[model samples]
Each structure stands twice: as C-alpha cells, then as structure tokens.
Target: MMMIELLKPDYIFESSWEVCNKVGGIYTVLSTRAKTLQDAFPDKIFFIGPDVWSGKENPLFSEDENCLKDWCAYARESDGLKIRVGRWNIPGSPITILVDFTPFYAQKNDIYGQAWCDFQVDSLHAYGDYDEASMFAYAAGKVVESFYRHCLSKKDRVVYHANEWMTGLGALYLRKHVPEIATIFTTHATSIGRSIAGNNKPLYDYLFAYNGDQMAGELNMQSKHSIEKQTAHHVDCFTTVSEITNNECRELLDKSADVVLMNGFEDDFVPKGNTFVARRKKARQAMLNLANKLLGTKLTDETLIVGTSGRYEFKNKGINVYLESLNRLTRDKNLKRDVLAFINVPGWVGDPREDLIARLKSKEQFTTPLEVPFITHWLHNMNHDQVLDMLKYLNMSNAPESKVKVIFVPCYLDGNDGIWNMHYYDLILGYDLSVYPSYYEPWGYTPLESIAFHVPTVTTDLAGFGLWVNSLKGRFSELADGVKVIHRTDYNYSEVADVIKDTVSDFSALSAAEIKKIRKNAAAIAEKALWKHFIQYYYEAYDIALRNAEKRLAL
Candidate 1:
C-alpha cells in the first residue's frame, strides 16, 4: 500500500507560494506536501519563496527581528540579493526562509512598474489580491536565481524544480549561466488561457492581437507563450501540474515538456467516517437554512446541493459558466429537480461586477427556485468601492422571488457556512458531488481533494486534475465512480448549459449504494495519490537533472 517509495530525489528545490507564504492552489500544493518531501529526502529538499517582509506592523515578526536580521544578512551576503533565510523548528522540515529584499524592490519596480508594487503590498494584506498575479512570479524568480547562484558557488549538485511561471525565470536564468545545472519548469496554469478565460476572449486573439505581450512587457513579465517557449527550449526538463496543461503548452507554445506530474491532496487533513459525518451534518444544516432563507423553499433531505467554491474570478475560474448553467437547468421543466447550488466565491475589489449583474439577470428568468449568495467582506482592509458597486449592481438588477435568494454574508466565516468556506476540503469530504468547470486551471487541487473525501468531482479537460482523472478513470471505476471530466472547449452560454445539464443529469441517477461504492473507490485512489507516493517524484526529477548534468560533465 506504500505506493510512494518509487522515485527518490536528492536536493529537491521547490519554489512555490507555499511553505511560509500562500497565495493560491500553488501554496496548498507546496505546504500540504512539504512534509512528504522532507520525509523522503530528509534535509535534502529545500523549500524556497520570496522572503515576504511582514515584520513592520505585525507583532509576529517584531519578536523575531534580531534573528530575522541576522538571517537576512546571511542570506543577502550568501545570495547577493537582500535575501533572508530562517528556519521554523518544525520537525522533518527544510531550512525555511522569509526572504527580505526590499532594497531590490525599486529596481524591480523600475522594470515592472506599480503593478508589481501593488501585488507586493497585497501579499501582506489579510485578503490577497488574486488578480495581481504577475508580481509573485517575478519575485519568486528573483529568489530562485539568487538561491541557484549561492548553491552553485558552493558546488552543490542540485536539481532546481521551479513551480509555475513565477519561478520559471530562475530555471531559465540558471540554464543560461550554468547549463550543467539541472532545471525543471512547472507551469501550474498558463497565462494565455487565464487571460482568455478572465477576459472572455479567444486564446489566439488574446495572445497575438490584443496587447497582452506589450502589457506583460511593461510589467517585466513574459507573455504566456514566450514563457512556455523559453522554459521549454532552455530548461533541462519541463513539467506541468496536469497532462492538460502539458498539451496546452505543447500546442500553444509549440514546445514539449518531459513530464506531467498530477497534483495531489493531503490525506492527513481530510476528515473521515464519523468525524466527517458530524461536520457534514453541520454544513448541511447551515446550507439548508441559508438556501431556505434565500430561495424561499424548504430543502428536503433528498434535495441535491451541487457545491462549487474557489477564488471568485468570473470567467476564468468558471463562475460565470456555472451560474449560466444553473440558470438554464432551473428553466428546463424536465430537469426541474430540487437542486441547490452553493457558490462559495468571495468578491474581490478590482474583480469585474458586470458578470455578476449578467448572471443575476439570467437567474430572473428561471422558474425553479434558486438561492445565490454573493459573499462580501466587511473588514476595513477590503475595497469599499468594489463592495458598494457589487451591492449597487445587485440592487439595480431584477430580484427574483425570495425563492431565488442572493444573500451576501459580509463577515468572514472560517468554513462554518458551506459557501465562502476556506476549509472546503472538510466540507467536500461530505459532498455527494463537487463541480469544477474551470476555464483555466493549471493543476486543480479541489478535484483531488474531493476524491480524497470520497466525493465524486466534475472537472474540465482543461484542468490538470481532469487529465489525471481521465488517465485513472478505468482503475477508479472499478473501485467507485471516480472523477468525471467535462470538456471546456467552448465558453458560449449555450455550450456551458449543455455541459452542466449533461453533468447534472448523469449525476442525478446515482443510487445511494452506488455513491457509497464510488466514494470508497475515490478514497482508495486518493490514498495512492498522496504526497507519500509522489514526493519521490521531486527527488527522481532531481536525480534525472543531476544525472544529465553529470553526462554533460563527461562530454
């Protein structure tokens, strides 16, 4: 049952949003999976990210100033980039560093402008700006470059595994300077697909016609195609979170990667059996109350509540698509099932509200009761204007009868409500079915997390998880009705409706016994896919890189 001892890596350098800092799914991947790497590689694995400077206003860093300063100096002198390295006394962990290089901030700003500056500031804020996407990638690259330079001078035989485009620049920089050093680039999600999805434009038009390259250049970041092309041509090896991303890179960037390492979930974090039963009961009750209050309907135990939650980006994360599909499903008399859609998307200040208005308009046309809550934050740090604008849009739109309620929970609930819950992994373990119709997902962690909860998940072929799920469908089907992969080839309203209708219809007929069987199968599959099994992939990748370096040395 120990499926992870297959590949062992020496000196695995994982640069991601995780470890001490977190931004999105990339953070989850690194932090949740770090212990597994440490267990497999011992002190050989190094977790690297920007030494986020958060000590000024916070008491957390005030207590550790002296140590932070000393470590910062050592990191700077050692790496030559105002860097800082420190270790948390966690067991079986690598030397974690909160790198501080504010001195270099101006230089980066001169190159990347205020966008980068805004992103850096947002990182310190309680609620991060997901749209300020470019800064972390550039900063992470700088960290990697500095780390690689420091390691090289010490004659370290290391395999540099850079996560996403943020750290891909480090691998590229190292390859140019030290070709013998092994380097791998992992693109969790492509910039091109994200832009297209978010902007509601065609990928080709977004890349070539629209001024994406020009805009990115102004920010000192590479266009999606350019980054993929450069990483593919230069790095010792190129990997992606999912096979879908791999194919996208190959087709879109005209370059091939060496591997497609599917993303995974932490088995230890997921609640199981009786523990999950209690949590599920609470979540179900909370959801029902909210649904009844908003939709004006008493949801029965048999009412199917299809849940979807993530960072609230309208087009790209498929929020708009999901809403449109719900509108259509509710309108279809034949498909008129007592289904409640729990959308757990938190509103961001700069995020577009126009899409929300459009969805509200469509929901007005629906006859079946719909309950939609647009969650907002009341905290002082939140953008007041954006919240007001969202409220304004909602007020101006035609309100459906209380049957279709749009409740805005403005306070932060730490996963108590099924919607806008951070601890969705806990909630999903109790879910009958989870839906992820992402227009762009590098390697989605939700589907895998759902699988771990023994919940059948619906993901798109565009996601990295979808690719892996498709690969393991036969194996998983034997155990239970594993993950269902939907094709996201079109983004038109009609097309999205068809996909959602098909998915809901297929899921509706599942017998409770069948669902239980599938849940068991999903858990078994997830057990094998845990970090324990694949942390070695990092080590093995490093070994390949080091071996390649040695062969080059011989030549």
Candidate 2:
C-alpha cells in the first residue's frame, strides 16, 4: 500500500470556546486529541481560548509568563489583547492562550458591524451569549493575527482552525485580515440543527425540507445561524466532527465539509494493566458504597452498575429516555441481577446533600431511605429539576424489592463533589454498562469513553459514534458487541426506552467469561478510535486548507 503525502503546516493555531475551559465534549475532543498533534507538530501548534476564569485560579491551566513573555507583553501593550500564556494541564501540556475578552465588550458593536460588512454575518439580531462569545472569538482572532504578524513569517505555512459557531467570527476575521493564513472552521453541530432537535422538532426527516434561514427566523437563531453558515461558506476547509453533522451542514448551512474530522482520544486517559484493574475495583467499591449508604441497600458487587452522562439537555441528551429505560428495566422480570443506573448529568446543583454525606461517612448501614434519596446533590429547585421531576412522575423510588434503582448525581465529579471524591472518568470506570441514547448527539463522546474503559455502551444510531460502530460491524450492534447502537427516532421514544430496558436487562445476565470477552471487545473498539487512526482526517483537512490558501495566494 502506498502512503499518502499530506500537506504539513509550518505552524497551526486552533481556537475554540472550550480549549482549556472544560465546558462540554469539545474540551474532551481538544484535550484528548492534543497529545497526537503535539507529537507530530511539536512546537508548531498553539491553542486559544476565552479567559472566562479571569484572575481566578484555574486548575486546568498552568501559567508560563516566561514562555511567551515577549509576545504576551507586546500583544498586551500594542493590541489590548489581555492574554495569559500557559500550558493546559492535559497529557500534552500544549501551549495555550487564554484571552480576557472583557476589554473587548466595549468594542462589541464595531466588531459586529465589521463582521457583518466583511462576512455578511447578521449579528444585528444577536442576543444573550452571542455578544460575549463573538467578542471572545473576535479577541481570539486578533490574538492570532497579532501573534502571526509579530512573531511569524509570511513564508511559513500557517493554518488557523476555529471550532464551533462560537469561534466562527475568529475564522471570518482571520480570513479578512490575515488572508495569508489558511483557515478551517469545524462545527460539531449546526446551530439550527441543534435548535430544531432540542425544540422537539423532527430534525432528520424534515431536515432537507427545512430552510436554515427560515428556521433561524422562527427559532430566533438568526445571529448564530448567520455566523455559522457564513463561516462554513468562507473557511478554506470547512469541517464537521462527523458525517451526520456534515449532512446538517449541507442542508442547514448549504455547504458540505471539505473533510469530516472524527473526534478521537489518546489512550493515556485510560489506566494500564494492573492499575486499570485496581482502579476499576476501587471505582466499583466506591459506587456500591455510595449506593448502599444513600439507599440503605446491600447492593453488593453482584449489582449491575450502569450510567448515562453528558450535558444535561433534558430531551436532547436523552436523560428522559435514560430515566424511562431504567423505569422500564425496574419492572422487567428478565433482569437476573439488581441494576443501579446513575444519571450522571450536571444540573443547577446547589450543593452536596448533607444527609447523604453523613450517611456516606457512617459505618452503620441503616436499612431505610434518606430524604430525596434519588439524588446525591441538593439542587436549587427540586420542583423544577427535570431528572427529579421525571423520577417522581415514574415513581422511581430507590425502594427495596425493586430490581433496578436510579440515582441522580447532579454535579461535576471533579474529585471533590462532597459525595464520591473521584473524578468523572475514575467514577465512570466502575460501571459495567453506559448509555447515551441521545436525540441530538453530533458525536457521542460519553459512550466512546465508556467503551474505552472496557464498559459496554448503549447508544443510538442518531449518534455519530453509534453509526460508526454499526459501520464497523456492517450491521446494527448488540450489547455483546461492546456497543449496542439502538434505533432512535423523534417519534420512537417508547420503542427506544424498551430497547434500552431490554439491553440493560440482558447485560445484567452475561456470564463472567462472556463479560470479559465483551470488555476486551470494548477496548478493541476504543483502540480503533484513537487519535493515531483518526488524526489522518485532520491531516487531510490541513492539506485542503493549505492548497486552497495557495490558490488564493496565487490569484
């Protein structure tokens, strides 16, 4: 087989709303994938993110004033681009620029007007976080622009990649100001597509018939749609995280991706050999201990641990369906073992439950429930909390004699949630099964992460990861295959719930040997999704951008 010669850039500057700030899946995408790029590109790559932390101590960042002291000083003095040069506290520890965009709020109108004039971005209808995100993006563009002009050469091949609609303005700004630099704009999910799906609209079936501009108007999403659509059209190599999102782009943004950059991860996040086993054991014990203390149950190692985790979009993230599935599973007589389902989505959490904390500390295992035993965290409004409300509606008490129980962990498990002091990944490894039956997942990282930790996952064909799994198998997968990609549709909530119920019930009955094989298969599936394999798509994207930049330069 002949190797393809991809265009390698002399310098690469990538910008995102989630670079070092751990907001959502994009943070995982960038942080996990950074090791591969750092290895390949060495010192040629830089990441820019919004300094939302301000002067507060950010655990994710390690400031290095001396590393880029000259540029930091120059950029601040000359451009008013308040930036903190640091290394992100991830595997690669890649150079990161966290720009304070507070200073740019005063210039918001001028920036919006300039974007409108240059790229036809209709920021006139902007609202809420639009101005904030745009100003940050604009600042990132100026940050890159100043860095490029001051510290870089015209002869050096440079590519500026912007992630999501939040960074679309930066890509547009770079194009208008620094045309010498190639640009790539990646949209994980189209603004209109997510809006359509999140609003309970039939997205896939009605996708082609839906006009983006029309939907943007109806949904009051004109500003975001305008920026995203215009950026996709203008970028040298427009990309999406998956093929499904690319389809959304074709219909919603009227532009096809030059390449699909499938999100991938480094295996360094997963523990090795004995450490893996030890950690998995500890995680399981921790979870079981928490459940036993909270519910006052003797849910031992025999219990089947299951969970669903992601951003808490009640309908879109399928928290509703996950709860419904667990509710259905509770009644299924086929469930051979006690199933403990954890709804690990963060919400408007007030604090950790004091009663639960006290119970967790006590040696006595009281055989009774605590108040609001379903959740470990105290939410601001228990009445308005969707997960708790759904639990109440389903009558899903952590009742004794029930075959299954659901627990809502409504806080970020950052090693100090006051309940289980384990990080999200460490806590998640305890699970035998994970589910992300998403209604609007562009790329499902939660399920992918599950499989990486040798945990079988149940996701939907509506998810890009699920589709990719099916493609690998050439047919729909089952729990035994490490990933069970359920068929999910807008109208098939009940059917999807039943499938998850059945899947979890079946997963509970697998023999130890069968379970080991399935776990191995899960690891194998995750290996195929590592950045070593998936980073080729990024190379392809770079080649497209560089060649396009060359064409523009020639003219």
Model number with the top lDDT: 2
Error of 1 at 544 (Å): 3.0
Over 269-296, each residue of candidate 2 has an lDDT whose tens digit, in order, gives 7898899999999999998888888888
Weakest 10 consecutive residues, lDDT, candidate 1? 118-127
Give candidate 1's error at residue 161 in angstroms.
Answer: 2.0
In candidate 1, position 165 carries an lDDT of: 57
Top of the candidates by TM-score:
2
Error of 1 at 97 (Å): 1.2
Scored by lDDT, model 2 comes in at 0.90
Sum up the clashes in candidate 2.
0
- After TM-score superposition, what is the CA distance of residue 347 in candidate 1 from its true location, in Å? 1.5
Q: Where is model 1 more than 4 Å wrong at Cα?
A: 1-10, 56-73, 76-84, 87-93, 106-156, 176-180, 203-228, 293-297, 332-337, 349-422, 474-480, 491-496, 505-511, 551-555
